[model samples]
Target chain A: MSADQEQRTIRCLVAKVGLDGHDRGAHVISRAFRDAGFEVIYSGLHRAPEEIVQATVQEDVDVLGISILSGAHDTLVPEIIDGLEEYDAFEDTLILVGGIIPDDDEAELKELGVSEVFGPGASMEQMVEYVRENVPEKE
Target chain B: MSDLIDELLAGKHRALARVITKIEDRRSGHRDLVSQLHQHTGNADVIGVTGSPGSGKSTLVDKMAATYRDRGLTVGVIAIDPSSPFTGGAVLGDRIRMGSNIGDMDVFFRSMSARGSLGGLSTATTDAVKALDAFGKDKIIIETVGAGQNEIDIVKTADTVMVLVPPGSGDDVQMLKAGILEIGDIFVVNKADLDGANRTVQELREMLDYSDGAILQSSGHHGAGSMEGTDGLQIEAESEGWDPEIIETIAQRGEGVDEVLDTLDSHATYLDDSGERERQARTRYAEEIRTLVREDVNDLMAEELDHRGGMDAYLDDVVTRETDPYTVADELVGPLADCVRDRRKE
Candidate 1:
């Protein structure tokens, strides 16, 4: 592993994608990540998929979490994955989805290479443990 | 030199980024890393940009950094974002505005949480800047979270400071009047396309006129809070004047960026011509050294107290008010004073 990959600090980007004006979950999870001693960059509301990809790559975050409570997860999440690929960052970046994701859509999201899907009322502790357990080592 | 330092000196981006992370985390051995990086710094220009939250400071920084990059200068940006004390998470959205420079080999950007600090910067900001400096970035831009009285510490570290005021934000400058006026070397009326840009500029000019000879001193290179030698002091800014030029800009469209860069270059020239460059360098070194010594001494005293089991007694005395906090401090300070004297004798 490269020295950066061996780094113990887990850097994450917590973003609200789509027209989801609801950001309570994003705020909660972002704070939870930080309280867990992870370095987190909370991207403010209404960020486009391209902006999210750009932030993930530029900030060198280990995880890209999309909080879509507007029920537009399928479309926005795929676009974000595409944006990451367009930026040549898909392979190195881990994708995560949160907020209002239905049970049926979880498998599809995983097929789209999302590492995990978080539905409503999920605890911050579970999310924190998941990120710590799953964040990929840097190249 | 160790392998990581060698990689950093050879301009490896990953190594430089790792060093910055280490310093920000205060990881084990980070102090040694900072000390090693210190010798390799002093090449990059450190510029600080501060403004209220909605003043478009991020977009302004994006344009400024791009302007430098177009001149073939490598840029490293340290964007500070305030952390939520309750949750400890921060919305570091500066990268969203600076998207244009992403994926460029010549640009490096990192967003740091202020870590619950109200001071507008992370404590490790200076060390992170040094890591970038040692990594061969010609320009380092530090974009503060937002401006406030406590945020003036940026002036102590940056060579030039640009304070931004957005249009329609009336009384914004008035709120931070003295601290901002005394510290800013260049005042920018950002979002100049808005309705109140001219008004903001007028207010800033009025404040400048009202306070004459608050002119940046020769050794006042870093502005107010500078402890540097002021040998060739100019009484009036108009005499050896740098009027703290108020430039208007629509940063989103990249308008007036050249003028901003030009102002920065002129300030660089002024520092050199006024012989403030060497003096500012000395001042920065002394400040860093003194801060380090103070922290080291405090840490050593704590360790000594911990070792001798005196910490509990000290706390009990203060808690019971059996002795005042100051008196307890006085009792503990003797060991530290002796430690310093012994080191000097050695």
Candidate 2:
């Protein structure tokens, strides 16, 4: 690929926010992004809501994937939205959540500004395509 | 473009981040961004921290950055991890250890993967450092993946390098003896709470002493007249009139790390007073120019090859022994020579 095409590549940050220590999904998705020719930043495990927002903004990631398996999705997802709002990044950034989120909490999460939620058995290809389709084109 | 450059120089955080992404991706216009921002750099002191795996290098960097932050200095950290060769993926875990400083606006932390680079850093690491430098960071710490003899390229770009020696890792001592000693401006005995902490310190001090003693012993006996047979040992020449210091630290506990920062400050002062700062700057600039020239040549070669069928034809010739590889290389170089001259004219 041309260097210019490589530079215009999508940038994604896969994060584990709040007390959710489980990161197998985060790792799998992050590697998928990179293998799919995107620049992926894995923020490791056990990140706070503010830290997630700060990392997302500073890294200028087009898509922010929060993997929370701790069942605190309702509490933590809102905090992440508030963080994005506080930083005035909500309009520009696309948010996605992946974890063992209960089916009942899915609608509220989307209501809380999460664009999509991938529960158990979500395929890597599906998530990758979702992000690729969602983020806006580069200027 | 100039407006974006102006925003970046004015410390627009988002602009700085965008430029870094562009550079890291090797995107078009990255050269313009770098060339324009180049003059705005040199204000930030770049420090490199490298050690072996499980050497507590990340923790040390975290503590040292906190120390700099306490002194009201803005810190930018670039922590690198090796890419998975099989998967082209990496889990850059340094930011996890440095989670405590996540909320601090003064601190900007980015995790990087080596991206198949043989060296201990990404190809864009220095450019990223330049971005951070232009963003007004007072200090930029590049924490490289714990590397061995061949991956010390961080030494070339850093104003001062801190080589961490974890206690109880006897192999690190041996590695230092092999060649890593030359790159260090400061030696840190990390995890001092562990056993062999004192022993590690003693071993490092002994290594430094022996090397220094050997140089002097040879110089005195030969009256500084002969450059041959200095105990059959060739020491990497360092800046004259400066001694590398050794500090002991337990980074996880936040113990003894302040002294490491203090020693780094002293090293910076030494570089300024001894004129080594200018020398280091010149070395980095020269390296950047050489790399750009090489890239330009590669671009011309690629264009020529694409126009002439492709690599398959050349490889088919080599495979069938129809033509020699050297001849093919010469044919390729024949077109590149003029293109290089034209580039110089431009």
Candidate 3:
């Protein structure tokens, strides 16, 4: 990485959408991002797609990590993506999905614009490295 | 840069966010950006809410923002969280409690980290407030990183400062007697639905009454009284005769939020009527100037050290007792002092 890129702090937003009160995974990932020297904003549980998108745009974060174990990623992730596109935030934000996902749905989610998905037992190091490699360069 | 400012002034949320980023990072030309924003400020009523951890500051602020929005006022919120002193990273979770204003574009909420600021607020916070103010937000709320006695810098930013006290913590009330009591324009007993809420309120009221009497007695004596205000701004506000209000709130259920809003409105009127607002602004501007100059001089001193073959060159001499720290400081600053003296003579 260039010196400038290394110096620029990556801002990430880890959000739990749609009534999934189970936030242990979200808290763990947020800590992981902080340890990796990135500023992470955790959107507390039971957020709507529109709320997540609004936060993403207003925060101007580099990465959007949506943690959903409620098995509703198919319905919610697309709406989040659509909201981001509507606000012109999709192009700059690299989206990552964590929690349960069927293999078929994972591919379709990626087709919609998710950069990566982490299933259960994914290493913290792996998620951090993926973000370092994939986050879009800030202008 | 001008284009970015134009976009921000045109009420674009993305541009405002980007400008705030520039301010937070201290990117080149940020000072210029903020300077240009000065003319557009002074319109928004800035309210600062601070308390201890889990004191329901976020929940109360969320409800307050929603209340203001319901009243047809545009709102902007800047919630501060502490940065990890080791890694300079932060997990800002204040947005979670702010679910009330979620899909509303009129209510803009952004989170900030302390970024190694010991005062619990970095200079970026003041500048970010300016950015939001310049963007035409009617009400701007600054939620501090849970405050301790020394973390009273919120007084320098907000028009009216509200300190939240959780119910049943008599020790918490005593803790406030140190620094926060003098700065708070209003004290809120949040989580009023909890046990011992009434007792907490009574303790707070007693404390405020004691402080009020102390301030009144001190002002009358001018310089002879023990409770003479340490902060000039506080003295000005006290002399204006605006007593701090203590109110109870159940923030989680949005109860007592309207009363909080009413208190804020009355405080605003008091500031305007008493001319304390103008006095506070003057003091704030003076402090801002001093802070900026201090930072610039520190940067220059660092560069001067580097130019003198780094601190190692001086360190060895000091370590061997060949030169004392005072002597080294004098040697390093001598040239700059002489240059300034020479300019005065010219």
How displaced is residue B197 in candidate 1, in Å? 2.1
How do the residues A46-120 of candidate 2 rate in per-residue lDDT, one tens digit apiece? 888888887876777888888988888888889888877776567777889888877679988888888999988
Ranking by DockQ: 3, 2, 1
* Each model's total of backbone clashes: 1, 0, 0
Fnat values, candidates in order: 0.21, 0.41, 0.51
How is the predicted docking of candidate 1 categorized under the CAPRI scheme? incorrect
The candidate 2 chain A region of ten consecutive residues with least summed lDDT is A1-10
When candidate 1 is compared with the true two-chain complex, its DockQ is 0.22
What are the clashing pairs of model 3?
A: none
**Candidate achieving higher lDDT, 1 or 3:** 3
Q: What is the TM-score of chain A alone in each candidate?
A: 0.90, 0.91, 0.94
The TM-score leader among the candidates is 3
Grade the docking of candidate 2: acceptable
User: What lDDT would each prediction earn against the true structure?
Assistant: 0.74, 0.75, 0.83
Candidate 2, pairs of clashing residues: none
Ranked candidates, highest lDDT first: 3, 2, 1
Q: Against the native chain B, what TM-score does each candidate's chain B reach?
A: 0.86, 0.86, 0.89
